[model samples]
Target: MRLESVVPLIPAELVAALDHSCGIRTDTDLLFFGSSLDIIKKLPLGTVTLSDLEKFTELVAEQASVPGHRGDEILAGSRRISEKHSQASCGVKELDDLVGGFGDSRVFEISGAKGSGKTALALQIVIQGLLADADSCALWIDTSGDFSAEKTAQLVRHFDLAVSDKLLERLQVSLGFNIEAVHDVLDALRNSLSSSRTVGPAVQWIVIDSITPLLLPSLSAVSSQGHAMMTTFMRRLRELAQTFGITIMVINGTSAAAPFNQSSAFASTNRKPALGPSFTFMTDCTLWLSKTKDMPDSEGPFSVHVAEVFRSRATRSRIWCTFQIRHGVLSSTIPDL
Candidate 1:
């Protein structure tokens, strides 16, 4: 409270003297910070009686505020938990444990050389997620137009027709040859999901298999527009994911040389992830997949594969797990200690 606010309680003769000469304008100023004796000394010795100062002090003391909590104390009281409330497995237990599993409202990137099984890994996770939660569905965006239905069916061939058919039915696949194509697909998909009367299971996951083609053409040494477009594209994807609680996974194939974004293409052998370092922080986590040595005591088709956590906010970077693809299924393998 200001000195004027307590005017009725304060003596009329003392108002101007205490307010101006004392410099105690606010209720806080009138508190003990400025000693009562100091205030009395500042006032006219004859005009203000000690009894009058005591009365004024009592009135202002009623309006003084208590101290508040410090920033560190408040932060300590509200410490955060990093674990996600809901997690969708990657179908391999060891692999799932390696990177904290896929969770809602986060973007994940899988980058690797061609034939390293990036697409296969993404598809398996989606299928497993759908099976794990019956109410969940997924959107598969095939950017290169070569997404194989036959291969996808092969993985679910062992299951009964009813289960397999329904899972595949719930999965909606679309071709997106360019950035515009994928953006349109995502926009329409988001709109359809917003309706309360949606036709089927709610979409809970999205896989953009190989984002190279969609973004490669827009990049060059002199142009920054491509990067801007990429940022916007990712922003929209994140918005959709957060709004609907969808988990987004993007496949980023590698390039042979550091500056060979144009030379590199999806489904081809390359040395590094295409596009450039811009992808380092675009996603919540980055998993690098690559084919390793063949499994011993088995047929040649099943080779040991490695999935490394190149970057993550929830898991330690550079940590990796090994698995094998046997009979169209992913199985976790423990390496000798």
Candidate 2:
């Protein structure tokens, strides 16, 4: 089936030649409708005709221009479209209630300074998914060289999640040293998910532990180009979420607090994330982790970490919760709540 032969098979009247300069507008609507009507009349009726009618109506709605009529037609005849994905518990009841858990088909951001338990949270998300289903799996892209198998196993054991060979086989881990490596890993993951018909049911979560390291190399050298690249990468992550019906968690490191200078007020506000506006704009939810000061003495083995949901589209109220990490497992600090 050569393209040339296929082209000749199409009705010459339907095909527009390069030299044809006629505009498709109100003046030519009748001619266009006549051509389309003739083509449809040739097709088999019943199912094909009914199925195409809806698509044709949508096409007409897009190009319609009957002063206020387009809105009415679309509203009355068309259905609202939205991405579909399942929601899973984030291992903490308060956080789950705050943001409706980690929503599939959405990008969630966890930003914080060093030793803020960002990686610990990400690993627990994987464990949670596995706990939900024995066969459930997750992908971890370690851009910061901090992913630990020992920690993962400890979390699985402490949480009593699936720890069999089959469960381990389902989980996929890839090390990404640089931005190019990260892109390559994402591409490979996308292809694998696309090829497998049952990927959505098998793979439940994907985490990029610390996206800041991948951008640090170019942040000072080519600021504009670096931002553009970061935007592209974030967009791709969003697409992967929507297309695969999976939750995406990206860990981002924040900038160091500026030296206290009484002369400048803006110096104190420099505690934002490293990548800036583009990264935050793409995420559906952004949570920041900060170490709490002067906590009451407790006999617990692990210290408590606080999470603040500063930006989120899923919930209206501002939320803050305290959780603890012990032996790689995470749990709410307040047991009564």
Candidate 3:
């Protein structure tokens, strides 16, 4: 009845196939994990089929309970009942109303050029999550070196939220200078997730403050491999989001484009997000952040930043909202046009 005796009874090909698909690095990975073997024990002894093993693998993955209901549960609901859209806000009313805040187990891609307040908004999200709940946690993968602790502190105080060690400690920051370092951080997260216990405040949010800089350097040199790596990284991110019910926001730099407000229709501008089509398809929502021409000192002192929901799975309505940084915090205004 022990796992060692049961392991030999299972076919090697089934194990190999599972390893390839599940990224099981070693044999120990297949045998270990406290609950995994428990599922396998239900199968008939000394006669394990591939179907049974596959079922066991699926049961193991289900350990990471998603925030939403399963497909079967959704289908079983009354036909007259409408699907509910649950979202978590970032403490910004206008922003929340626009994109329905950040949904659970979804990826939000914020595309903008440099100096377009991407980092500012990202910090605000972390602050919001911490402020929303005392135990809420967030992770910042600073590949672009744009995150600032001092500024975050200023915003935390600006909101009049308690600036205690516990609140500050809730937000974890990892500065990955190179792609290898980024991979290392992801590997650590994966390992941490394998355990049944909660790891590091049950991380609710993960922000990659601009993923372009890291991949852009090598993308030209090894286009195929670079694209593949980027895709894999995003896939792993998606898995993490689904498994941990974390909201992922990846900062993407956009190519410059001439301003075109010719028609009311949402036109696709030359300003494309980094990672091209592959990334667009993978993202659940894409928000383009752009800056209009600077206003004169008389018109307005601060520069205006517009956030357009160019692509979204939740709603088709094209939303255009404006926000400005005041006292190191972003204040979102009503939609303009």
Q: Give the Å error, residue 326, model 2.
A: 2.5
> Can you write out model 3's per-residue Cα lDDT over 21-128, one digit (the tens) per residue?
444432234434335455345434554555676665554344323346678764444221221114366666777667767755678898877667777787787777
Return the TM-score for each candidate structure.
0.69, 0.67, 0.69
lDDT of 1: 0.73
lDDT of 1 by residue, 1-337 (tens): 3455466788666767776787655454566335677777887768677777887788766544333568996454323212322557876888888778777457888898877778878888888888777888889999878888887887866443458877888788999887767866876787698877777588888999888888888778896656755665776676677667788999997767533333222233246677787776888888888787765554536767778787887788877777887666787764661
For model 1, the stretches where C-alpha displacement exceeds 4 angstroms are: 1-87, 159-162, 257-270, 296-300, 334-337
The Cα error of candidate 3 at residue 148, in Å, is 1.4
lDDT of 2 by residue, 39-82 (tens): 45544443235345345434443433223447775443322212
**Candidate 3: worst-modelled 10 consecutive residues by lDDT:** 78-87
- Candidate 2 ranges beyond 4 A from true positions: 1-87, 161-164, 196-201, 220-223, 257-270, 293-300, 335-337
Q: Rate the local accuracy (lDDT) of all candidates.
A: 0.73, 0.62, 0.65
Q: Local error of candidate 3 at 178, Å?
A: 2.4
Weakest ten-residue segment in model 2 by summed lDDT: 18-27
Task: List candidate 3 stretches off by more than 4 Å.
Answer: 1-70, 73-87, 197-200, 220-223, 256-270, 293-301, 334-337
